[model samples]
Target: MPKPLPLFTGLSAFPLTPADEAGRVDTDALQALLARIIDGKANSIGLLGSTGVYAYLTREERRRAISAAVEAVSGKLPIIAGIGAIRTDAVQALARDAAEAGADALLLAPVSYTPLTEEEAYQHYATVAATTDLPLCIYNNPSTTHFSFSEDLLARLSKIGTIKAVKMPVAKDLAFAAEITSLREKAKEDFAIGYSGDWHAGSALLAGADAWFSVVGGLLPHPAAALTKAALAGNEAETARIYAMFEPLWVLFRAHGSLRVIYAAANLLGLTKARPPRPILPLPDTLLPEIEKAIAALPER
Candidate 1:
Protein backbone atom coordinates (compact mmCIF):
# COMPACT_ATOMS: atom_id res chain seq x y z
CA MET A 1 0.00 0.00 0.00
CA PRO A 2 1.04 3.63 -0.56
CA LYS A 3 2.41 5.53 2.39
CA PRO A 4 -0.02 7.86 4.12
CA LEU A 5 -0.14 11.35 2.55
CA PRO A 6 0.82 14.45 4.47
CA LEU A 7 -0.96 17.75 5.29
CA PHE A 8 -1.28 19.19 1.78
CA THR A 9 -3.04 16.13 0.37
CA GLY A 10 -6.66 15.86 -0.90
CA LEU A 11 -8.95 18.46 -2.50
CA SER A 12 -7.25 21.75 -1.77
CA ALA A 13 -9.54 24.56 -2.88
CA PHE A 14 -7.87 27.65 -4.42
CA PRO A 15 -10.15 30.65 -3.87
CA LEU A 16 -10.10 34.00 -5.67
CA THR A 17 -8.71 36.93 -3.74
CA PRO A 18 -11.42 39.55 -4.02
CA ALA A 19 -9.83 42.95 -4.30
CA ASP A 20 -10.66 46.40 -5.59
CA GLU A 21 -8.92 48.47 -8.34
CA ALA A 22 -6.46 49.68 -5.73
CA GLY A 23 -5.50 46.03 -4.93
CA ARG A 24 -6.72 46.06 -1.35
CA VAL A 25 -8.26 42.69 -0.52
CA ASP A 26 -11.95 42.71 0.37
CA THR A 27 -11.61 40.63 3.50
CA ASP A 28 -15.39 40.17 3.97
CA ALA A 29 -15.82 38.88 0.40
CA LEU A 30 -12.81 36.57 0.86
CA GLN A 31 -14.23 35.18 4.11
CA ALA A 32 -17.56 34.54 2.43
CA LEU A 33 -15.80 32.51 -0.29
CA LEU A 34 -13.94 30.51 2.38
CA ALA A 35 -17.22 29.73 4.16
CA ARG A 36 -18.56 28.08 1.01
CA ILE A 37 -15.42 25.94 0.56
CA ILE A 38 -15.44 24.86 4.20
CA ASP A 39 -19.15 24.04 4.02
CA GLY A 40 -18.52 22.06 0.84
CA LYS A 41 -16.12 19.81 2.79
CA ALA A 42 -12.92 20.54 0.85
CA ASN A 43 -9.94 19.00 2.63
CA SER A 44 -7.77 22.14 2.59
CA ILE A 45 -7.68 25.79 1.49
CA GLY A 46 -5.07 27.08 -1.04
CA LEU A 47 -5.21 30.83 -0.53
CA LEU A 48 -3.44 33.50 -2.59
CA GLY A 49 -2.74 30.95 -5.31
CA SER A 50 -2.73 31.77 -9.03
CA THR A 51 -6.53 31.83 -8.84
CA GLY A 52 -6.20 34.10 -5.84
CA VAL A 53 -4.00 36.48 -7.97
CA TYR A 54 -0.99 36.25 -5.69
CA ALA A 55 1.28 37.82 -8.31
CA TYR A 56 -0.98 40.84 -8.60
CA LEU A 57 -1.38 41.74 -4.92
CA THR A 58 0.91 43.78 -2.72
CA ARG A 59 2.62 42.07 0.20
CA GLU A 60 0.44 43.98 2.66
CA GLU A 61 -2.66 42.76 0.84
CA ARG A 62 -1.35 39.19 0.75
CA ARG A 63 -0.76 39.31 4.51
CA ARG A 64 -4.29 40.62 5.10
CA ALA A 65 -5.74 37.85 2.94
CA ILE A 66 -3.87 35.20 4.91
CA SER A 67 -4.92 36.65 8.28
CA ALA A 68 -8.56 36.90 7.21
CA ALA A 69 -8.55 33.32 5.91
CA VAL A 70 -6.91 32.05 9.09
CA GLU A 71 -9.64 33.78 11.09
CA ALA A 72 -12.39 32.44 8.87
CA VAL A 73 -11.03 28.88 8.82
CA SER A 74 -10.19 28.99 12.56
CA GLY A 75 -8.38 25.66 12.57
CA LYS A 76 -11.07 23.97 10.52
CA LEU A 77 -8.64 23.07 7.66
CA PRO A 78 -5.08 23.52 6.52
CA ILE A 79 -4.34 26.82 4.68
CA ILE A 80 -1.64 26.64 2.00
CA ALA A 81 -0.50 30.16 1.13
CA GLY A 82 1.05 31.05 -2.26
CA ILE A 83 4.24 33.07 -1.95
CA GLY A 84 5.49 33.31 -5.54
CA ALA A 85 7.50 36.39 -6.54
CA ILE A 86 10.05 37.41 -9.15
CA ARG A 87 12.77 38.10 -6.66
CA THR A 88 14.25 35.60 -4.23
CA ASP A 89 14.13 38.13 -1.38
CA ALA A 90 10.52 38.92 -2.21
CA VAL A 91 9.58 35.22 -2.06
CA GLN A 92 11.47 34.88 1.21
CA ALA A 93 9.62 37.86 2.65
CA LEU A 94 6.30 36.53 1.41
CA ALA A 95 7.12 33.14 2.93
CA ARG A 96 7.85 34.87 6.21
CA ASP A 97 4.61 36.84 5.93
CA ALA A 98 2.65 33.65 5.24
CA ALA A 99 4.14 31.91 8.26
CA GLU A 100 3.50 34.92 10.49
CA ALA A 101 -0.10 35.15 9.31
CA GLY A 102 -0.89 31.57 10.40
CA ALA A 103 -0.61 29.82 7.05
CA ASP A 104 -0.24 26.03 7.38
CA ALA A 105 1.99 25.64 4.30
CA LEU A 106 3.81 27.61 1.59
CA LEU A 107 3.44 27.27 -2.19
CA LEU A 108 6.32 28.78 -4.19
CA ALA A 109 6.67 29.19 -7.94
CA PRO A 110 9.96 30.19 -9.53
CA VAL A 111 8.65 33.54 -10.67
CA SER A 112 11.20 35.37 -12.80
CA TYR A 113 11.32 37.81 -15.69
CA THR A 114 14.35 36.06 -17.21
CA PRO A 115 14.33 32.28 -17.43
CA LEU A 116 15.86 30.55 -14.41
CA THR A 117 18.49 27.82 -14.64
CA GLU A 118 17.87 24.54 -12.86
CA GLU A 119 20.58 25.36 -10.37
CA GLU A 120 19.03 28.78 -9.76
CA ALA A 121 15.64 27.21 -9.14
CA TYR A 122 17.06 24.63 -6.72
CA GLN A 123 18.95 27.21 -4.70
CA HIS A 124 15.94 29.50 -4.63
CA TYR A 125 13.77 26.77 -3.17
CA ALA A 126 16.48 25.73 -0.75
CA THR A 127 16.83 29.28 0.58
CA VAL A 128 13.09 29.76 0.96
CA ALA A 129 12.75 26.36 2.63
CA ALA A 130 15.32 27.39 5.22
CA THR A 131 13.48 30.65 5.90
CA THR A 132 10.27 29.03 7.19
CA ASP A 133 9.37 26.00 9.20
CA LEU A 134 6.13 25.85 7.21
CA PRO A 135 6.06 22.89 4.84
CA LEU A 136 6.51 24.01 1.19
CA CYS A 137 4.87 22.74 -1.98
CA ILE A 138 6.69 23.44 -5.25
CA TYR A 139 4.32 25.31 -7.56
CA ASN A 140 5.54 24.01 -10.94
CA ASN A 141 3.48 26.36 -13.12
CA PRO A 142 5.81 27.07 -16.02
CA SER A 143 3.19 28.71 -18.19
CA THR A 144 2.91 31.67 -15.84
CA THR A 145 6.23 31.52 -14.01
CA HIS A 146 8.35 31.04 -17.18
CA PHE A 147 10.49 28.46 -15.37
CA SER A 148 10.11 24.70 -15.33
CA PHE A 149 11.47 22.41 -12.63
CA SER A 150 13.35 19.52 -14.15
CA GLU A 151 12.82 16.00 -12.77
CA ASP A 152 16.39 16.13 -11.49
CA LEU A 153 15.78 19.52 -9.91
CA LEU A 154 12.53 18.26 -8.41
CA ALA A 155 14.31 15.20 -7.01
CA ARG A 156 16.97 17.52 -5.65
CA LEU A 157 14.48 19.86 -3.98
CA SER A 158 12.41 17.03 -2.56
CA LYS A 159 15.31 16.28 -0.27
CA ILE A 160 14.91 19.65 1.44
CA GLY A 161 13.49 19.16 4.93
CA THR A 162 10.57 21.61 4.70
CA ILE A 163 9.77 20.99 1.05
CA LYS A 164 7.05 18.40 1.57
CA ALA A 165 4.91 18.51 -1.57
CA VAL A 166 4.69 19.58 -5.23
CA LYS A 167 1.76 21.03 -7.17
CA MET A 168 2.40 19.82 -10.72
CA PRO A 169 1.04 21.02 -14.00
CA VAL A 170 -0.67 18.48 -16.23
CA ALA A 171 1.53 16.06 -18.18
CA LYS A 172 1.60 16.68 -21.94
CA ASP A 173 -0.11 13.37 -22.70
CA LEU A 174 -2.22 13.37 -19.52
CA ALA A 175 -0.55 10.11 -18.58
CA PHE A 176 -0.76 10.77 -14.85
CA ALA A 177 0.20 7.25 -13.75
CA ALA A 178 3.50 7.24 -15.60
CA GLU A 179 4.23 10.82 -14.48
CA ILE A 180 3.47 10.09 -10.82
CA THR A 181 5.42 6.87 -10.85
CA SER A 182 8.40 8.61 -12.46
CA LEU A 183 8.37 11.45 -9.93
CA ARG A 184 7.85 9.15 -6.95
CA GLU A 185 10.77 6.97 -7.93
CA LYS A 186 13.25 9.68 -6.92
CA ALA A 187 11.24 11.79 -4.47
CA LYS A 188 11.62 11.49 -0.73
CA GLU A 189 9.26 9.05 0.95
CA ASP A 190 5.89 10.62 1.77
CA PHE A 191 6.63 13.62 -0.44
CA ALA A 192 3.08 14.27 -1.53
CA ILE A 193 2.44 14.79 -5.27
CA GLY A 194 -0.60 16.68 -6.56
CA TYR A 195 -1.79 18.16 -9.85
CA SER A 196 -3.44 21.54 -10.62
CA GLY A 197 -5.05 21.30 -14.04
CA ASP A 198 -8.72 21.35 -13.06
CA TRP A 199 -9.75 19.45 -16.16
CA HIS A 200 -7.37 16.57 -15.41
CA ALA A 201 -8.14 16.37 -11.67
CA GLY A 202 -10.27 13.23 -11.74
CA SER A 203 -7.76 11.32 -13.85
CA ALA A 204 -4.88 12.49 -11.68
CA LEU A 205 -6.63 11.39 -8.47
CA LEU A 206 -7.62 8.05 -9.98
CA ALA A 207 -4.00 7.47 -10.96
CA GLY A 208 -2.89 7.52 -7.30
CA ALA A 209 -2.01 11.19 -7.09
CA ASP A 210 -2.08 12.21 -3.46
CA ALA A 211 -3.93 15.50 -3.98
CA TRP A 212 -5.85 17.76 -6.32
CA PHE A 213 -4.66 21.37 -6.08
CA SER A 214 -7.78 22.50 -7.82
CA VAL A 215 -8.77 25.76 -9.46
CA VAL A 216 -12.50 24.99 -9.88
CA GLY A 217 -12.73 23.77 -6.31
CA GLY A 218 -12.21 27.37 -5.18
CA LEU A 219 -15.75 28.31 -6.16
CA LEU A 220 -17.56 25.04 -6.92
CA PRO A 221 -16.13 23.07 -4.05
CA HIS A 222 -19.19 20.89 -3.49
CA PRO A 223 -19.00 19.06 -6.81
CA ALA A 224 -15.22 19.24 -6.90
CA ALA A 225 -15.00 17.62 -3.47
CA ALA A 226 -17.58 15.04 -4.48
CA LEU A 227 -15.59 14.20 -7.60
CA THR A 228 -12.42 14.02 -5.51
CA LYS A 229 -14.02 11.63 -3.03
CA ALA A 230 -15.24 9.34 -5.80
CA ALA A 231 -11.96 9.30 -7.71
CA LEU A 232 -9.76 8.76 -4.65
CA ALA A 233 -11.97 5.84 -3.66
CA GLY A 234 -11.23 4.27 -7.09
CA ASN A 235 -14.89 4.49 -8.14
CA GLU A 236 -14.47 5.07 -11.87
CA ALA A 237 -18.14 5.00 -12.80
CA GLU A 238 -19.12 7.58 -10.21
CA THR A 239 -16.03 9.61 -10.99
CA ALA A 240 -16.89 9.60 -14.67
CA ARG A 241 -20.48 10.58 -13.91
CA ILE A 242 -19.42 13.52 -11.77
CA TYR A 243 -16.66 14.44 -14.19
CA ALA A 244 -19.16 14.59 -17.07
CA MET A 245 -21.11 17.22 -15.15
CA PHE A 246 -17.95 19.32 -15.22
CA GLU A 247 -17.32 18.77 -18.93
CA PRO A 248 -19.24 21.83 -20.04
CA LEU A 249 -17.31 24.08 -17.67
CA TRP A 250 -14.11 22.37 -18.70
CA VAL A 251 -14.89 23.32 -22.29
CA LEU A 252 -15.29 26.93 -21.26
CA PHE A 253 -12.15 26.73 -19.14
CA ARG A 254 -10.24 25.44 -22.12
CA ALA A 255 -11.65 28.17 -24.34
CA HIS A 256 -11.36 31.14 -22.00
CA GLY A 257 -8.82 30.03 -19.37
CA SER A 258 -9.88 28.89 -15.90
CA LEU A 259 -9.13 32.27 -14.29
CA ARG A 260 -11.51 34.23 -16.50
CA VAL A 261 -14.08 31.42 -16.67
CA ILE A 262 -14.11 31.06 -12.89
CA TYR A 263 -14.48 34.80 -12.41
CA ALA A 264 -17.45 34.67 -14.76
CA ALA A 265 -18.88 31.58 -13.01
CA ALA A 266 -18.55 33.23 -9.60
CA ASN A 267 -20.44 36.30 -10.78
CA LEU A 268 -23.10 34.19 -12.48
CA LEU A 269 -23.60 32.28 -9.23
CA GLY A 270 -24.04 35.63 -7.42
CA LEU A 271 -21.17 34.65 -5.15
CA THR A 272 -19.13 37.81 -5.87
CA LYS A 273 -19.40 41.03 -7.84
CA ALA A 274 -15.65 41.61 -7.95
CA ARG A 275 -13.85 41.13 -11.26
CA PRO A 276 -10.34 39.92 -11.99
CA PRO A 277 -7.60 42.57 -11.51
CA ARG A 278 -7.30 45.19 -14.24
CA PRO A 279 -5.50 44.14 -17.45
CA ILE A 280 -7.33 40.84 -16.89
CA LEU A 281 -10.76 41.61 -18.31
CA PRO A 282 -13.92 39.89 -17.08
CA LEU A 283 -15.56 37.57 -19.55
CA PRO A 284 -18.05 39.37 -21.76
CA ASP A 285 -21.72 39.21 -20.78
CA THR A 286 -22.40 37.10 -23.86
CA LEU A 287 -20.80 34.11 -22.09
CA LEU A 288 -23.07 34.28 -19.02
CA PRO A 289 -25.81 32.13 -20.54
CA GLU A 290 -23.32 29.41 -21.45
CA ILE A 291 -21.72 29.63 -18.01
CA GLU A 292 -25.16 29.29 -16.46
CA LYS A 293 -25.87 26.26 -18.60
CA ALA A 294 -22.59 24.64 -17.55
CA ILE A 295 -23.16 25.34 -13.86
CA ALA A 296 -26.63 23.79 -14.18
CA ALA A 297 -24.91 20.53 -15.14
CA LEU A 298 -23.77 19.88 -11.55
CA PRO A 299 -25.69 17.91 -8.90
CA GLU A 300 -26.70 21.07 -6.98
CA ARG A 301 -26.21 19.32 -3.66
Candidate 2:
Protein backbone atom coordinates (compact mmCIF):
# COMPACT_ATOMS: atom_id res chain seq x y z
CA MET A 1 0.00 0.00 0.00
CA PRO A 2 1.15 3.52 -0.62
CA LYS A 3 2.04 5.56 2.45
CA PRO A 4 -0.71 7.95 3.42
CA LEU A 5 -0.01 11.60 2.81
CA PRO A 6 0.00 13.72 5.97
CA LEU A 7 -2.62 16.21 7.30
CA PHE A 8 -4.10 17.41 4.01
CA THR A 9 -4.43 14.17 2.06
CA GLY A 10 -7.19 11.70 1.28
CA LEU A 11 -10.91 12.57 1.02
CA SER A 12 -11.19 16.09 2.38
CA ALA A 13 -14.96 16.48 2.16
CA PHE A 14 -16.19 20.02 1.41
CA PRO A 15 -19.60 20.61 3.05
CA LEU A 16 -21.89 23.50 2.20
CA THR A 17 -22.45 26.12 4.88
CA PRO A 18 -26.21 26.04 5.29
CA ALA A 19 -27.56 29.49 6.04
CA ASP A 20 -30.57 31.80 5.83
CA GLU A 21 -31.19 34.35 3.08
CA ALA A 22 -29.47 36.89 5.29
CA GLY A 23 -26.23 34.87 5.12
CA ARG A 24 -26.49 33.88 8.76
CA VAL A 25 -25.11 30.34 9.13
CA ASP A 26 -27.62 27.84 10.46
CA THR A 27 -25.45 26.07 12.99
CA ASP A 28 -28.03 23.33 13.47
CA ALA A 29 -28.28 22.52 9.77
CA LEU A 30 -24.55 23.03 9.32
CA GLN A 31 -23.87 20.55 12.10
CA ALA A 32 -26.30 18.06 10.56
CA LEU A 33 -24.40 18.15 7.25
CA LEU A 34 -21.12 17.65 9.11
CA ALA A 35 -22.56 14.64 10.93
CA ARG A 36 -22.90 12.86 7.59
CA ILE A 37 -19.27 13.54 6.72
CA ILE A 38 -18.18 12.26 10.13
CA ASP A 39 -20.34 9.14 9.79
CA GLY A 40 -18.82 8.53 6.35
CA LYS A 41 -15.32 8.77 7.88
CA ALA A 42 -14.06 11.39 5.50
CA ASN A 43 -10.43 12.32 6.15
CA SER A 44 -11.28 15.98 6.84
CA ILE A 45 -14.09 18.55 6.81
CA GLY A 46 -13.52 21.49 4.47
CA LEU A 47 -15.72 24.26 5.88
CA LEU A 48 -16.58 27.46 3.92
CA GLY A 49 -15.27 26.29 0.54
CA SER A 50 -16.68 27.69 -2.71
CA THR A 51 -19.44 25.11 -2.44
CA GLY A 52 -19.90 26.33 1.11
CA VAL A 53 -20.48 29.92 -0.11
CA TYR A 54 -17.40 31.38 1.52
CA ALA A 55 -17.32 34.32 -0.85
CA TYR A 56 -20.92 35.25 -0.10
CA LEU A 57 -20.58 35.42 3.65
CA THR A 58 -19.56 38.11 6.08
CA ARG A 59 -16.52 37.48 8.28
CA GLU A 60 -18.65 37.10 11.41
CA GLU A 61 -20.80 34.52 9.65
CA ARG A 62 -17.75 32.68 8.35
CA ARG A 63 -16.32 32.50 11.85
CA ARG A 64 -19.66 31.23 13.11
CA ALA A 65 -19.59 28.45 10.50
CA ILE A 66 -16.09 27.42 11.56
CA SER A 67 -17.11 27.37 15.20
CA ALA A 68 -20.12 25.23 14.35
CA ALA A 69 -17.96 22.76 12.40
CA VAL A 70 -15.50 22.43 15.29
CA GLU A 71 -18.40 21.78 17.63
CA ALA A 72 -20.05 19.26 15.31
CA VAL A 73 -16.99 17.12 14.48
CA SER A 74 -15.61 17.44 18.03
CA GLY A 75 -12.18 16.64 16.60
CA LYS A 76 -13.28 13.36 15.01
CA LEU A 77 -11.73 14.72 11.82
CA PRO A 78 -9.61 17.72 10.92
CA ILE A 79 -11.39 20.95 9.85
CA ILE A 80 -9.70 22.85 7.05
CA ALA A 81 -11.31 26.32 6.94
CA GLY A 82 -11.50 28.42 3.81
CA ILE A 83 -10.44 32.06 4.46
CA GLY A 84 -10.17 33.55 1.01
CA ALA A 85 -11.04 37.24 0.59
CA ILE A 86 -10.19 39.98 -1.90
CA ARG A 87 -7.90 41.69 0.59
CA THR A 88 -4.73 40.34 2.21
CA ASP A 89 -5.51 41.95 5.56
CA ALA A 90 -8.96 40.37 5.57
CA VAL A 91 -7.42 36.97 4.83
CA GLN A 92 -5.04 37.48 7.76
CA ALA A 93 -7.89 38.29 10.11
CA LEU A 94 -9.90 35.35 8.83
CA ALA A 95 -6.93 33.04 9.39
CA ARG A 96 -6.74 34.25 13.00
CA ASP A 97 -10.48 33.63 13.40
CA ALA A 98 -10.13 30.09 12.02
CA ALA A 99 -7.23 29.28 14.34
CA GLU A 100 -9.09 30.75 17.29
CA ALA A 101 -12.21 28.76 16.42
CA GLY A 102 -10.15 25.53 16.49
CA ALA A 103 -9.75 24.78 12.80
CA ASP A 104 -7.00 22.26 12.06
CA ALA A 105 -5.81 23.98 8.88
CA LEU A 106 -6.50 26.85 6.47
CA LEU A 107 -7.33 27.07 2.74
CA LEU A 108 -6.60 30.37 0.94
CA ALA A 109 -7.42 31.46 -2.60
CA PRO A 110 -6.00 34.54 -4.28
CA VAL A 111 -9.37 36.22 -4.61
CA SER A 112 -9.13 39.56 -6.35
CA TYR A 113 -11.29 42.19 -8.00
CA THR A 114 -8.23 43.48 -9.85
CA PRO A 115 -6.31 40.54 -11.29
CA LEU A 116 -3.11 40.10 -9.35
CA THR A 117 0.46 39.78 -10.61
CA GLU A 118 2.41 36.69 -9.51
CA GLU A 119 4.42 38.67 -6.96
CA GLU A 120 1.22 40.12 -5.50
CA ALA A 121 -0.28 36.66 -5.13
CA TYR A 122 2.90 35.28 -3.56
CA GLN A 123 3.09 38.14 -1.10
CA HIS A 124 -0.58 37.76 -0.22
CA TYR A 125 -0.03 34.09 0.66
CA ALA A 126 3.21 34.84 2.46
CA THR A 127 1.58 37.54 4.54
CA VAL A 128 -1.42 35.43 5.54
CA ALA A 129 0.72 32.36 6.19
CA ALA A 130 2.73 34.50 8.56
CA THR A 131 -0.36 35.51 10.57
CA THR A 132 -1.17 32.13 12.04
CA ASP A 133 0.61 28.93 13.02
CA LEU A 134 -2.06 26.86 11.25
CA PRO A 135 -0.93 25.04 8.11
CA LEU A 136 -2.34 26.62 4.92
CA CYS A 137 -3.27 25.06 1.57
CA ILE A 138 -3.09 27.26 -1.52
CA TYR A 139 -6.41 27.19 -3.35
CA ASN A 140 -5.51 27.27 -7.09
CA ASN A 141 -9.02 27.74 -8.45
CA PRO A 142 -8.77 29.96 -11.50
CA SER A 143 -12.29 29.32 -12.76
CA THR A 144 -13.76 31.29 -9.86
CA THR A 145 -10.89 33.25 -8.37
CA HIS A 146 -9.66 34.48 -11.78
CA PHE A 147 -6.11 34.32 -10.42
CA SER A 148 -3.99 31.41 -11.58
CA PHE A 149 -0.80 30.26 -9.93
CA SER A 150 2.09 29.63 -12.27
CA GLU A 151 4.34 26.67 -11.39
CA ASP A 152 7.05 29.08 -10.33
CA LEU A 153 4.71 30.93 -7.96
CA LEU A 154 3.45 27.62 -6.53
CA ALA A 155 7.04 26.50 -5.96
CA ARG A 156 7.81 29.81 -4.29
CA LEU A 157 4.71 29.59 -2.09
CA SER A 158 5.59 25.98 -1.18
CA LYS A 159 8.80 27.20 0.39
CA ILE A 160 6.76 29.14 2.97
CA GLY A 161 6.87 26.82 5.99
CA THR A 162 3.21 27.34 6.83
CA ILE A 163 2.02 26.78 3.24
CA LYS A 164 2.12 23.01 3.28
CA ALA A 165 -0.06 21.89 0.36
CA VAL A 166 -1.93 23.05 -2.73
CA LYS A 167 -5.53 22.32 -3.81
CA MET A 168 -5.06 22.37 -7.58
CA PRO A 169 -7.58 22.70 -10.39
CA VAL A 170 -8.04 19.68 -12.70
CA ALA A 171 -5.42 19.51 -15.40
CA LYS A 172 -6.26 19.76 -19.10
CA ASP A 173 -6.67 16.36 -20.84
CA LEU A 174 -6.60 15.00 -17.29
CA ALA A 175 -2.80 15.15 -17.24
CA PHE A 176 -2.66 14.84 -13.42
CA ALA A 177 0.28 12.42 -13.22
CA ALA A 178 2.60 14.58 -15.30
CA GLU A 179 1.49 17.72 -13.50
CA ILE A 180 1.94 16.06 -10.12
CA THR A 181 5.42 14.89 -11.05
CA SER A 182 6.45 18.28 -12.36
CA LEU A 183 4.96 20.05 -9.30
CA ARG A 184 6.66 17.68 -6.86
CA GLU A 185 10.04 18.31 -8.45
CA LYS A 186 9.92 22.04 -7.72
CA ALA A 187 7.89 21.96 -4.49
CA LYS A 188 9.58 21.48 -1.15
CA GLU A 189 10.16 17.91 0.00
CA ASP A 190 6.90 16.32 1.20
CA PHE A 191 4.98 19.39 0.12
CA ALA A 192 1.70 17.69 -0.74
CA ILE A 193 -0.22 18.11 -4.04
CA GLY A 194 -3.99 17.64 -4.10
CA TYR A 195 -6.67 18.20 -6.75
CA SER A 196 -10.23 19.55 -6.81
CA GLY A 197 -12.78 18.94 -9.66
CA ASP A 198 -14.63 15.93 -8.26
CA TRP A 199 -15.29 14.06 -11.54
CA HIS A 200 -11.56 13.67 -12.24
CA ALA A 201 -10.45 13.09 -8.63
CA GLY A 202 -10.26 9.31 -8.87
CA SER A 203 -7.98 9.52 -11.88
CA ALA A 204 -5.77 12.05 -10.10
CA LEU A 205 -5.48 9.84 -7.03
CA LEU A 206 -4.75 6.78 -9.19
CA ALA A 207 -2.05 8.79 -10.92
CA GLY A 208 -0.45 9.47 -7.50
CA ALA A 209 -1.72 12.89 -6.45
CA ASP A 210 -1.71 13.18 -2.67
CA ALA A 211 -5.35 14.12 -2.12
CA TRP A 212 -8.85 14.93 -3.37
CA PHE A 213 -10.20 18.22 -2.06
CA SER A 214 -13.64 17.14 -3.11
CA VAL A 215 -16.98 18.82 -3.73
CA VAL A 216 -19.04 15.64 -4.36
CA GLY A 217 -17.50 13.92 -1.38
CA GLY A 218 -19.34 16.42 0.80
CA LEU A 219 -22.81 15.13 -0.10
CA LEU A 220 -22.14 11.51 -1.24
CA PRO A 221 -19.25 10.38 0.87
CA HIS A 222 -19.83 6.60 0.98
CA PRO A 223 -18.98 5.99 -2.66
CA ALA A 224 -16.60 8.92 -2.65
CA ALA A 225 -14.71 7.38 0.24
CA ALA A 226 -14.76 4.01 -1.51
CA LEU A 227 -13.29 5.53 -4.65
CA THR A 228 -10.63 7.37 -2.62
CA LYS A 229 -9.60 4.23 -0.79
CA ALA A 230 -9.28 2.20 -4.00
CA ALA A 231 -7.43 4.85 -5.95
CA LEU A 232 -5.01 5.68 -3.14
CA ALA A 233 -4.13 2.00 -2.92
CA GLY A 234 -3.44 2.07 -6.68
CA ASN A 235 -6.32 -0.31 -7.27
CA GLU A 236 -7.27 1.02 -10.67
CA ALA A 237 -9.90 -1.62 -11.47
CA GLU A 238 -11.77 -1.04 -8.23
CA THR A 239 -11.44 2.72 -8.51
CA ALA A 240 -12.83 2.64 -12.04
CA ARG A 241 -15.74 0.49 -10.91
CA ILE A 242 -16.72 2.83 -8.10
CA TYR A 243 -16.12 5.99 -10.14
CA ALA A 244 -18.45 4.72 -12.87
CA MET A 245 -21.32 4.84 -10.36
CA PHE A 246 -20.97 8.60 -10.08
CA GLU A 247 -21.23 9.21 -13.84
CA PRO A 248 -24.77 10.59 -13.78
CA LEU A 249 -24.00 12.99 -10.95
CA TRP A 250 -20.79 14.11 -12.66
CA VAL A 251 -22.73 14.86 -15.83
CA LEU A 252 -25.13 17.04 -13.83
CA PHE A 253 -22.20 18.70 -12.12
CA ARG A 254 -20.70 19.55 -15.51
CA ALA A 255 -23.99 20.73 -17.00
CA HIS A 256 -25.06 22.80 -14.00
CA GLY A 257 -22.25 23.85 -11.68
CA SER A 258 -21.36 21.47 -8.82
CA LEU A 259 -22.29 24.21 -6.33
CA ARG A 260 -25.89 24.35 -7.61
CA VAL A 261 -26.15 20.55 -7.89
CA ILE A 262 -24.84 19.98 -4.36
CA TYR A 263 -27.22 22.47 -2.78
CA ALA A 264 -30.05 20.70 -4.57
CA ALA A 265 -28.66 17.30 -3.50
CA ALA A 266 -28.44 18.38 0.11
CA ASN A 267 -32.11 19.39 0.07
CA LEU A 268 -33.13 16.15 -1.72
CA LEU A 269 -31.13 14.09 0.77
CA GLY A 270 -32.97 15.99 3.52
CA LEU A 271 -29.60 17.08 4.87
CA THR A 272 -30.39 20.81 4.58
CA LYS A 273 -32.96 23.04 2.91
CA ALA A 274 -30.86 26.14 2.44
CA ARG A 275 -30.72 27.54 -1.09
CA PRO A 276 -27.61 28.91 -2.73
CA PRO A 277 -26.99 32.58 -1.79
CA ARG A 278 -28.39 35.03 -4.34
CA PRO A 279 -27.61 35.98 -7.39
CA ILE A 280 -26.77 32.28 -7.53
CA LEU A 281 -30.11 30.50 -7.76
CA PRO A 282 -31.08 26.91 -7.02
CA LEU A 283 -31.06 24.16 -9.65
CA PRO A 284 -34.46 23.92 -11.38
CA ASP A 285 -37.10 21.50 -10.14
CA THR A 286 -36.78 19.64 -13.45
CA LEU A 287 -33.32 18.43 -12.41
CA LEU A 288 -34.47 16.97 -9.09
CA PRO A 289 -35.56 13.62 -10.58
CA GLU A 290 -32.17 13.10 -12.20
CA ILE A 291 -30.42 14.07 -8.93
CA GLU A 292 -32.59 11.60 -7.01
CA LYS A 293 -31.59 8.87 -9.47
CA ALA A 294 -27.97 9.79 -8.98
CA ILE A 295 -28.33 9.64 -5.20
CA ALA A 296 -30.19 6.34 -5.34
CA ALA A 297 -27.37 4.83 -7.42
CA LEU A 298 -24.80 5.30 -4.63
CA PRO A 299 -24.15 2.89 -1.77
CA GLU A 300 -26.09 3.58 1.42
CA ARG A 301 -23.65 3.31 4.28
lDDT of each: 0.92, 0.91
Model 1 TM-score (2 dp): 0.98
- In the range 1-301, model 2's lDDT, one tens digit per residue, is 3232466889999999999999999999989888888888789988999989999999999999999889889979999999999988899999999999999999998999998999999889999999999999999999999888899999999999888899999997999989998998898887888999999999999999888999988888778899999999999999999989999999999999999999999999888889999999998899899999998888976
Steric clashes per prediction: 0, 0
Q: Which ten residues in a row have the lowest lDDT in candidate 2?
A: 1-10
Q: Please give each candidate's TM-score.
A: 0.98, 0.98
In TM-score terms, candidate 2 sits at 0.98
Question: Can you list the residue pairs that collide in candidate 2?
Answer: none
Per-residue CA lDDT of candidate 1, range 1-301, in tens?
Answer: 4463456778999999988888989999899999999999999999999999999999999999999999999999899999999899999999999999999999998989888889889999999999989999999998898787888789889989999899999987999999899999999887899999998999999999999999989998999999999999999999999999999999999999999998888888887888999999999999999999999898666
